[model samples]
Target: MSDTPELPWPVPDERFRHWAGQFADMHHLVRDLVIPLGLPQAAESVLTTARELIRMSYFRYEFMMIGAGTSIIAIEAALADRYGKGNLAGYLKKAHADGHLTKEQYDLLDSFGRPIRNKYAHGDLTHVALTPPLAIGMLRTAITLLAELHATPSPGPSAGGN
Candidate 1:
């Protein structure tokens, strides 16, 4: 059996009761606000939300990289966890080995990671200005990856197939 602690409720956070109450209120407010706006289809809403998440996360990544000026390795390790073991970087590296990353692109990503790691490490939200271009790029990349993953065949055969 696992050694994880059993809690009274699923989410255990005793110290933040007030904050949690405020959060729940805000969540209800947002839901009420958006419900009247007549949103798109559920699938489209999910895609839109996912795109925003990727963009925001990348911006957060950048801010952290810039502020810390170190801890890039740890940040990348955490990203590897989120992106899964078979992430783009790992897959590309495995595909080409020596040719995985071009010198210029690798250097650019390395440069970007430095400060982003800092923001993530320090938990500071002071430097959050959304760049349209970055958001577009990240969103497009996310959509493409999601599409490709959806397109790929799963392991199991069709219901009637041998």
Candidate 2:
């Protein structure tokens, strides 16, 4: 048997996109973003997957939930390579203490532990309807935060994808 657990929802087939090619296609600010030098490959992979899922959310907006939720987990995974252990919350303190993140950045992400991160993780019904703007913003926060935690200041936000 495959080790993968059964998904609660319908399995996505090759034709996952609906009304795709109808528009110019979704874009993400994080697309082609550079991860900090020496960042863990596994972490970078998760982060990419998270962003791609968010971009795909434009086709099926509900995918925003998966994207938003995965972004938090991506942050946590990035932390595992940088810090010792624990989830995003505990690691943020360590990241902050090390001058990896600014107070404002730390505070914003630490605050996400509840209404954003945890709720999505637990499959809260309200969170599934998470808006695209909110989900995209969360991902931006995650990518910037991860970059800071590693090294090299972020290039800073720019106008999002066309």
Model 2 residue 97 distance off true place after TM-score fit, in angstroms? 3.4
- Among the numbered candidates, top TM-score falls to 2
Residue-by-residue lDDT tens digits, candidate 1, 84-136:
46443453343234333345434433444334434545765346442423333
Which 10-residue span in candidate 1 carries the lowest summed lDDT? 29-38
Model 2, 28-70: lDDT tens digits are: 3435444455656776776678777766655555666677778
Q: Model 2: runs farther than 4 Å from truth?
A: 1-22, 28-38, 125-129, 152-162
Candidate 1 regions with alpha-carbon error over 4 angstroms: 1-46, 50-122, 128-130, 154-162
